[model samples]
Target chain A: MKIWALQDQVLNPIEQKSIDSFKAAGGNGSLETFGNDPYKQKLRVAIGSPNAPDVFFNWGGGNLKEYVDAGKIADLTPVLDQNPELKNAFIPSVMDGAKIDGKQYGIPMRGMQPVLLFFNKKVFAEAGVQPPKTWDDLLSLVDTFKNKGVQPISLAGSQAWTELMWAEYLLDRIGGPEVFKAIRDNGAAGWKHPAVLESLTKLRELIDRGGFGDNFASVGYDMGGASTIMAQGKAAMHLMGSWEFVNQQDQSPDFVKNGDLGWTAFPAIPGGKGDPSNVVGNASNYYSVTSDSKQLDAAKKFVSTTLHEDSYVQALIDAGDVPAVVGVEDKLAKAPNADYTTWIYNTVKEAKHFQLSWDQDLPADDATFMLTQLQELFLKKVSPEQFVNAVAAR
Target chain B: MQSQRPSSWYAVPAFAFFGLFAALPMVLVVYLSFTSWQGLGTPTFNGVANWSRLISDGEAHASMGRTLLLMVVSWAVQTPIALLIGVWAAGKQRSRAVLSSIFFLPLLLSTAAIALLWQALLDSNFGIFAGGPQFLGDPDIAIYTVVFVISWQYIPFHTLLYQGAARGIPASLYEAAIIDGAGRFGRFFNITLPQLRYTIVTSSILMLVGSLTTFDTVLILTQGGPGTASRIIPLHMYITGFSGFEMGYASAIAVLLVVLGTALSVIVTRATGFRAMSSQQEGS
Candidate 1:
């Protein structure tokens, strides 16, 4: 049985360690690394190659649908039903995405909150302002930042997904978590919902106010670009993924060293349907065995061992990742944002419902279209009605 | 001892390789263009549907238009500037060596490295050339930067061609012109221009082919962004074929590109008298 682990950057440093561990455990599974940032899209390895990895890493959303439809993955329904103990080990929503037509195809690994507001405490202090908790309050801060000649939010407009963060945040604020789930899940009730359109309209207002950095569209989503604006204290806030915090710690040790980072929940829309707990994210990198693989037994065992409590904790800890396993000892004693992860987990735990990542849950072709449509929305090239209509067309 | 023409049978192996790699694949692409293949499942015959989509699709038209524009921009804009520098560097030994080395520097860098360097250079915030306009972000300015990047890399190749072409012209032509009271401009227009025609046409054709099909540089630089402003056809084909996974649609675009390229090549050949000269046996 040939087993291939299509791993991510978190597993990159300790690849040999995991591989050695797998080998010591008498496994035939081999590991092959893929993307560094799981949130970012990357071209999957070429298909039908002699060296095509049997089991691979895939996003847990509609991306799975594309690959599954392509007939490149193995169905794990039989194994999933047999091992209820294994199924109980990880987050349910994560595994939910891996299931198509009641058949499990992937194992959920690390979970990341892709959209969170990280504000520079020092910048807020200098501006003589409090962290805003309401839509009106944030708008006031926007005015204050404008008066002070600083960008309110350091956004990378060029990054297709980064721009969608605002829309998702606003969706949660206006319609609460239910609306988020409805819209993200492609539920018929949510597509034409006024809350989604209103959310986009509000985001447009922010763009009109120049909340994003000047020429943000040119900036790639990296440590060197708009994220640098926050690290350098040029911007008051950065709404990005949790991975930015991990990367920031790696790149500029001293700049964010103090972990002076403060998180304010995206403000609730005035007279809207949602609560602050309505969140936007999912289990980060989901792993699956290809249906094309000759070795289903080895693939299942490989997943079990790699995600075993002890091995998962060690690997996740070494890589500064949040393990998806239900109960693991929190050994992040020295992690600067250990509290942040805790808060994130707690917030997710308290949420009434989980809204799968909006862009991910949509049809694969629609993912790019939604991102592009939002671009037009931001540029005023398309109105809110037009944006909704365009998505509907897709 | 004549070896019976060295046996045309010896050409079989080379012909076989070409057929296997190129001819067979090209025929397959044509077939694929008329079918719907999602790069995975067995292709379903759709016939003319992909072609019909190509005609109606805004993105497809944009890709073809961009490819043509890039061809014109690189050949018309970059080649002439390169020629000027090449002409200026022709006789001065030290200057030629220095200018030649400087011009060739960009070609040494990998496409990724060149893009990273240019991104830094064109970065709207901290870049050296950032102040006047946000080059990469602005659709208007983005193509120019792409043009500049393509041109900068092509300069050395063009310079070498021009230098060799100028040198290939007979010194006797210049000497005879000088004696006939023809000045430098007269010698150049009457002598240099006519002699370098074949080289210019060949190089321009090469440039046109190259610029039309270029992938790595523009892809890295823009990824066909700022709302597909710099999305050339090849990049469009890539996004459709790879990202969108519409192999048949992408192949249709590819076939159209090949047709466009062949037509342009023919036009260039006739326009530059390349075809006439070759027919007259002036060309080797």
Candidate 2:
């Protein structure tokens, strides 16, 4: 079998061990990995090469959408039909991202919701404050945490993705999916839209109120610095996603487990157009077959086997991912942040709309433009009106 | 001339070097500047469209302006510091070689490695000091950080060049200047400065050219961000071609960079009387 599979973040020790076992079993498969790189312009050179692996991991929205539009990948509707028994194996909306114009072109494999709001249980206990259920409560909690000599949240405001997520949370909770769709589809929002302005204004207030850590703008998202404030109990809450589990697993694994790690939906806006349950993302990352694969059959089989097999699901679970595959609740018993995964899985299962994360769903240029605007606005270089107008013009 | 073939055609080798390395790339770039090509497909002629787009493109112009500013500031910051250090080390013969080698250490390291090292050192988290400045993140300070790192790496190169030139100056001239009551500063300004004109001009030209195309260091340090605050021209071109996937537009920017580089070289050469210095070499 001429087989090659491309995946990102699937090269950890656990996955490496599984690949070795697969090889030892006399399966002829090669794995090529793309490590969380966002620049599709560079990726296209690889995708268009003569020897591109049959199956490669990519983002579902713009990246896969572009490849599908270019006719670079196979329509996996037939594959889904063949595996009718496993039709509901993956989360529906996450799988929806891989579909284009009503045909499934890619299958959901790995997923993560890395930016979650994690509160320090110890801080909460000390301050005798409850995890806020509403946006007003959260705002109040920030002041309470500060009064208790602890920060409320750790924010890498300079990291464009982090800042963009701030806007997305506010949009989902206040402006709703219809408003987001309108704005994304047609730039339809006025500069003075309350939801649009409130998101930026609230973030600025958070900064001014010392909710984010000292020099938070300078820290990287995954680095220990941003997470340190939460991990050390110096902060009461951290707005991050599943990636923090990896950072926490090595230091205080128990803190991540046993109800100490709290996961909540981003707080609701008091007077917003959007529903609070309109979560901010679909599948976080996906793998797809590139256009230049020499071993199409092998590649398709590898993807089919890897994603459908129990071993692969188990392997991914051990690697700190919230797997899209269903019926693996038992395998997740040992997960350090099983509660967080359960919360996301349960919430995603019933969500009415899977709002494609704005940063990844938009055209590459437009998304980059958004990221730039977010950084500029967060740094207070531009006003909220200017930011809204900037994105609208672009 | 020898009875056989004359060896005076050394200029042929020089011309060959320029043809292979410099002239051909220039031709390719100029041609590419006129075509709409995405790195993969066949080139389609687009006339002056790319240039026109670059004219109105705020991002392109901003990046170009930043590139020129970086060149000026990096060279200005690096040259005088390097010259002063070179003179100081040369005066202290015992530690001159050690200090010179240490100073030029950045030159010996790869640009990416140096940039990454500095990034880590300047990182707000887990850097040398607690809460180090956002050298690569904050828009307000990113450009200066980039300049500081660029100058840090280049000072040693120019220092060594100046050191060699200063040592080459005849001791007798310094002795005569000292006898004529020219103090240390006076002797340096009058004797050392006049004699090292060729070395200084050559180094200046090299630095100016090097700064114009500096890519790897700035790329690693910031990737030209906090919203194009520290982005130089080459970086802008790379993003346009590799990130934005607009290879034709990137090529246009590249061609313009060549024009800018050439124009700046001409202006600096005129200002520094570099041609006059070269003529003096021939006359001697």
Predicted model with the maximum DockQ = 2
What lDDT tens digits, residue by residue, belong to model 2 across residues A1-394? 2223334444444445545666676655555443344435446665556655566656677656656765677777776789776567887777877777788777776664534577788789888988877878888888898788776887765467776767777767766776666665455343346677777777777766777755666666554656665777867887766566666766676676555766677777777777666676546556566545666665555566566577777777766677877766777767755766677776776666677777666755567667767776766777777887777775
What does candidate 2's lDDT look like per residue over B1-284, in tens digits?
65786676868999999999999988988888898775543578999999999899877788878888888888889889988887776675787777677877888998889988887788765677555556666777888889999898888888888887777777878888889999989998998787778787888888998989889988877777666688788998887776556678888898888887898789988988787654322225
Model 1 chain A: weakest 10-residue lDDT segment is A36-45
lDDT of each: 0.72, 0.71
Q: Look at candidate 2 and tell me the lDDT of residue A363.
A: 55
Lowest-sum lDDT 10-residue window in model 2 chain A: A1-10
Question: What are the RMSDs of all candidates, in order?
Answer: 3.2, 3.7
Best by TM-score: 1
lDDT by residue (A251-356, candidate 1, tens digit) is 6677677766677666767787776766676545666776656666777777666764576565675567666666543655444367766666565555554555
Q: Where does the lowest 10-residue lDDT sum fall in candidate 2 chain B?
A: B275-284
The DockQ for candidate 2, computed on C-alphas, is: 0.43
Once superposed on the true structure, which residue ranges of model 1 sit more than 4 Å away at CA? Answer: A1-10, A13-19, A35-52, A69-72, A176-192, A329-336, B1-4, B92-94, B278-284
